[model samples]
Structure formats: structure tokens, C-alpha cells
Target: MLELDGTTMCKPGPLNPSIRAHSSTLTNKRSRRIKGCGALWGEIDHAQGVPAMLLISIQTLLRGALMVGGVSVVLAFSPLPVAAQERMPMRIAVEGAFPPFNYLDANNKLQGFDIDIANALCETGKFECQFIIEKWDDMIPDLIAEKYDAIISSMSMSLERRQKVAFTEKYYNSPSVFIARKDSPITDVSPAALNGKKLGVTSSTAQESYANHFYPDMKKTVFRSSPELYKGLSDGRVDIILEDKLAIYDWIANTKAGTCCAFKGPDLVDVTFFGEGAGIAVRLDDKERLARLNEALKTIKEDGTYDMINAKYFPFSIQ
Candidate 1:
């Protein structure tokens, strides 16, 4: 405390007895206050009539309190405001080789049923989005890890997968079938015809499921992709390939083996083996994002965009 010792200032300092005594008194008071506060900062008020250090300390405390309070509020409401929600380009994953569902179009673009539907969804949901190609087998694991925000590669809805990822209602319907080389002699075949022959299918797919369930007598050969399954048939490694009907028709129509193979027999998709139509796959944790995707899917299906996407790929409706 820099006290203005008013009683001692008027006394002369040339060995004046009263002046020496007053100076001693003032020193005592300053020492007492400094000992109490452990600071010379609290002495400023006595000299200047107001303390800048005290005001600064008070301001710092208030600011710190506000910071803690703000953190608590943010923690309590993690749902950020629209602007605060991190603005990121939505990434949609696709199985790049699946023609008409999401193949590399002639122009080298991801174009197909899934691609168009996903674009419309981004537009309706007001988000910037991009599509990236990935293998089908990696889709679920990648999606769960948030490698992409969603997948729109004609992934089907099943009770098993539903336990892992969220799905929209059916986007479009199609059937599954088998493609056999015309010379293979399996085209004129029955489900029983595959009894001893090796039939190829994509692993973990509806085709694989149907093949195992319906043709339990056959040797089931599973590959990682539909193209690979077809390749196995082409190389005579497998008698035929079981997969999506439209995929078979499209590939056979577009390839050198066009004259060599065809989709033989009726559609294997009877809800008994193949589940309902395909839908977009989303992470299970993103309730908000999932809701937006579902709404967009519903709107497109109703306003005929989805049907148009259907017409571009499949010729007949699934009953």
C-alpha cells in the first residue's frame, strides 16, 4: 500500500522528531498491506486512488468463466448450427464396374442408376457431393469407418446388413439371374441341372445366397465381384455365373462374348432369395444425414426420377 501519509508530509525532514516518527508509521502500514496481499499491485489503489492490476485480474477471471460456460453449452448441445456444422463435400461410394447401376460410362464418368439417384439426392438435400469408386466387398467396412458419407451402388436391403448400416426404402427393383456360355449346355438347364457343375457368384451377394440356397446340390464358386464371376465362366473355370439379371444382360450385350453367352432361365429373384429392391447405405450413427437421404430418395421415387433411372437400366418392373 503506497499510503499518502498526510499527517507526516507537513513535518520538516531535518532530524524533526515528529517527521521521523510519522515516516516510520507510514512504512509500517505499507509493509503490513504488502505482507497480506504478497503483492505491490494492491498498493496502487492507495497511491493512484484506483488499481489497474485489480481491474485486469477481475477481467481475466470473467473471461475465463465465459470460456468455461461456452464449452459447457457446446458440450450439452453437440448439434451445431447449420453454419457451424462442418461444411464438407459429401462423398458417395460406388462399385465402379457395375454397369447402369454405377459403371464408368463411355465418357469415363460414374454414370448409372445409382449415380443419377445420388446426384438428385445431393441437389435436394443441399449438399456438395462427389462419387468415388470402390470394391463391393469393402463397402460395409469402409462405410462403418466413415470412409465415405454414404453408398449408392445398388446395395440391397437385408436384415443382416440392416444390423450394421442404415438403409433407405427401396430405390428401384431388379431381378437376379445366371449367365452361361451358349456352348456350356447349361442354358437349357433347371436349378437341378447345376447339381454337379460349378456355378460362380459374387461372394456375400444375393446371387451367392440364392445359388447356395436353391442349388444346394451344386459346387458353389464365389468370387469378389460379378465381373470376376463372369470371367470365371468365360475361362470355363465355372459353368455359369449367377448375378443380377440386368448386369448379365448389359455385360453380354457390350462384350466380345456377346454372341457366346446369354441370360438363361427365369429371374431367380422372387423375394424368396433376393430381398426387396436396392437402397442407399448410410452410417448407422448419422441420424440427421440418414433422414435427409431417406427424404430425398422418397421424393425422387415419387416424382418419377427414380422410375426414369429404372427405365434407363431395367426394361421391366419387378412384381
Candidate 2:
């Protein structure tokens, strides 16, 4: 008699002296037992009382049996080709609120540079990839919790963040800048120039860190998303906002609300706050996946695919 357990196989009666009892845990976390039948049939001698035909049948049965909630269920088994088996799609997380980089369209479909870049990398690498929209503040935490495999969001590679996750080579680089109403008197972003004015920035972003570090005395209003932060500037709730230059440029050139605001000062390039640039993020232990992404990034750039995507969003090269 044979029995299947979640991780071990057992025989009820005495063991056969001729055949040594053996067991093994399968990749799927299930195990099965036939008295004195080792994990591999080749190890068994035909001279033993057990027939070769019977042993082959038992092996087939063991492969098909699956344990579910303490009950054994037999399922039809068909092995797929190695290539077909390796085609499983990797899950990628993106914040669907950052425009020009990534955002939801009027149709609510994800569309932007990050989306295009992610698609290109996956295609060049022969990897199937799926994108999941996630909150900005929750991106890192959820990634660590295994909710997704990697983050292709425009996340800056700052030293503070490197303590938790690893980043691939930068896909794009843009400087931080300040935006304010065209009519506002604040021509300079110096903290002394705008003593009592309200400043807006998205929470848990590189821009926020920059503002907190450089303009610690300025009154700051933190928003949950980029759209909300932009709205705060337009609605007169905030006197100015600090954000990615390319993103602000896209708003000023494309959206109606952006017409009320304009770039306030020169580009801010403090590396302490902005880090290097935006890169894909994965768990610290996922070095193999990181290498695969870096190779794919190189392939796309060398093939002109990355240039094509960049031109779709910005007139100037951000790389």
C-alpha cells in the first residue's frame, strides 16, 4: 500500500529486506511512498518480488497525485517543454500617477515613457512582464512584502533607499525644479526670498527630501500624489512646488492647469537629495533578475528602441 503526505511518504507494513526504503521531497512539496521503492526506479533490482511494470505504474501514480487540505487528488500530468515552462511573466509594479514617466490615460489604461521602456526591455530580453499599479508611498514596502517582483516606477536611486532594495542602471535622469504661478513674486527659490509662502511636494519622494533638506524653514504641504501636488499649486493652496523638471515641463506644455504655473528657478542638481537617476528596483536578494534587467536595458539602448520611446515624451534627451 502507498500513501502521500504533504512532505513525506510512508508505508504501513514491514519493509522488504531486499529493497532499501527511501523517500524524497518533490519540488511541489509533495511526497509518496511504496514499500522499499527508492525515489528512482533505476535503483530498484528486477530480481526483487516487485514487478518492473508495477513499479513504473506506481511512479506514474505518484507523479499525478496531489494533496489538497489533507485529501489526495489525482490529476492528469503533461510536461511542457523547457522553453514553454520558462515563459512565466514577471510582475512589475508602477505608480500609475506620475505622467510622462507613467500614468493612467482617460481610458484608464497605463501609458507613458516608463510603460514604453518596460515593454521594450521585456521584449528585448524575451521575458513576459505584467504591470501592477501601486501607491507611491507603498511601492517599496509592498515590494519587500513580495506583493510584486520589481518596481519600474521613476524611483530615484538615493543612498537612503539603497539600504532596503537594489537598483538597476538608470533608465532616465532629470533634475529637480520649482514651479509657481506665473504672476507670483517669488522669482528665486531661496528660503529667505519666500519666508511665509506655502510649498507643495509629494510625500516620500526625492523632491520632498530635497525641499526638507534645503528649505527646512519654508512652510511645506505634503500631498499623496503628483496630481494632487500640482493641483495644490494651481488652486493657490501652495505658493510653489518642487518636482521633476521633465514632469513639470510636460504639464506646462500639455495641460490647461499648468498654464497658470511656470518654472520658478534654475535646475536643482544636489546629488545628496536627488541621488543619481530613476532606476528599476528589486529585492536585495534578486541579483539574477537585476542582471537580466540591466542586459535588457543595454539591448534596448543599443537597438534604438530606448531613443524611440524617449522621443515620444520629451523633445530633449533626459538621459
Q: Report the number of the highest-TM-score candidate.
A: 2
Clashing pairs in 2: none
Worst 10 residues of 1 by lDDT: 31-40
Q: Which ten residues in a row have the lowest lDDT in candidate 2?
A: 24-33
Error of 2 at 173 (Å): 0.4
1-319: candidate 2 lDDT, tens digit per residue:
2211111222112212332322211122111112111211223222223456965876878776778998989777554322223332456777767887887676445678887787666655544455566667778987788766689889889988898999999999989999999999889778788777899999999989888877888899998878888889999999999999887788899999889989988998877778798889999999877877887788878988788888888887888
| lDDT (tens digit, per residue) of candidate 1 on 1-319 | 2112111111111111121100111132211200111011122111222256855765666554345745732222233333223223466677766765766544444566666677666654544454555567778987887766778887877666788999877777778877788876665557666788888888778777767767888887888666667778888898877788766676787778556777877876567556677877888888888777776667766777667766766676532
Steric collisions counted per model: 0, 0
CA displacement after TM-score superposition, residue 251 of candidate 2 (Å): 0.6
Q: Model 1 compared with the native: what TM-score?
A: 0.66
Where does candidate 2 stray beyond 4 Å? 1-85
Computed on alpha carbons, the lDDT of every model, listed in order, comes to: 0.62, 0.72
* Cα misplacement distance, residue 295 of candidate 2 (Å): 0.2
Task: For candidate 2, give the lDDT.
Answer: 0.72
